[model samples]
Target chain A: AQRVTQPEKLLSVFKGAPVELKCNYSYSGSPELFWYVQYSRQRLQLLLRHISRESIKGFTADLNKGETSFHLKKPFAQEEDSAMYYCALRASGAGSYQLTFGKGTKLSVIP
Target chain B: DTAVSQTPKYLVTQMGNDKSIKCEQNLGHDTMYWYKQDSKKFLKIMFSYNNKELIINETVPNRFSPKSPDKAHLNLHINSLELGDSAVYFCASSPMVGGGGGDMDTQYFGPGTRLTVL
Candidate 1:
């Protein structure tokens, strides 16, 4: 059974403060993780993927295989960054095509 | 232009009625998918089509049917809808998996259709 868990349903942070949205997954194969964001009244969009190893909009997430985690982090939180974030995982072997998404975390960067 | 788009951003209807939500993608991607997001904000994949072929089908009710006439279009039709079906339905697309690094495949989502069953 593959599952993605985002423990925090709501995370509030002050502007310029550091932010970390935790995510964990349960899977038996290699993991391809991603962080997606949905801003207010906007469509859900891709923020970043672990495989890209790149930062998007000052947010970065690293795939921790040992911990089975892919936590999204940002040194400085911006008000515009407040949105619903989802952590997803994809299997590597035979079932690598479909994505399993977490319940999602709502990050509120209060000014 | 939007890569993925869905019609009827807001739909309000009664139970026992049938409805259809249309989706189209202009990214020329080979894979398209339908997802359901409940009020609790839990998103789950309902169906997936790649190059006009059904590749992934989650445990969805028979009343919820998806139709994809081509690689660029995938529509969902619900028959005798129930109140429990009220939720946000999202359509997404992505390039074919595997080939140029499967991990690089990123799905682009539509604005989503909010179905309100009364």
Candidate 2:
């Protein structure tokens, strides 16, 4: 069974501090991983995907196949960065549109 | 303009009633999906349609049915709604995989519809 796990239900950090939200996945084949963010009163949006390998909003996530992890990280946390983060994994194959998502982690960047 | 939109941002009703949630996407994508977010905020895919054809269907209850009249519209209907159905439903669309050069992995989500079963 394919599953995504976000162990931290809530992660609090002071402004300007480094931030990391852990994400791990269990899949038999190669997976396309993504990070999605939902801010207060805003619709859920895509933050970034491992395939793109591009940083968004100063946050970066590296896919570690050996560790089966794709932890999102930021050098300096900002108040605006506070939101619910979800880690999703898509199996790489034909006709697979389902995104297996982890229970989201709420990040609170306190000023 | 909203890329993806869902009707009735919030729905509150008694259990055992029937209801429907409509979703539409103007992004011209070839694939659309429905996801349910539980109270714990665990998002799970319920169904997916590609070019108006059902492509993926998870282990959702048979009481829940998804209809896609076209590629841009996908609607979900629930019969005899139960308390367990109280949650947020999100509609999303993405470019078709193996269709072209665009990023098919990135999905655009609609404002969720929060359903409360009293």
* Number of the top-ranking candidate, with TM-score as the measure: 1
lDDT of 2 by residue, B15-74 (tens): 999999999999999999999999988888999998999888989999999999988999
Candidate 1 wrong stretches, greater than 4 Å? B99-104
Q: What is the C-alpha local distance difference test score of each model? A: 0.91, 0.92
The runs of at least 3 residues in candidate 2 whose Cα sits more than 4 Å from the true structure, single-residue gaps closed, are B98-102
Please provide, for model 1 over B1-118, each residue's C-alpha lDDT reduced to its tens digit, 9 standing for 90 to 100: 8579999899999999999999999999999999999999899999999899888899999999999999999999999999999999999999876434443478889999999999
| Error in Å for residue B17 of model 1 | 0.2
- What lDDT tens digits, residue by residue, belong to model 1 across residues A51-85? 88998999999999999999999999999999999
- Give every collision pair in model 1: none
TM-score of chain A of each: 0.97, 0.98
Tens digit of per-residue lDDT, candidate 2, span A42-62: 888999988888989999999
* Model 2 TM: 0.96
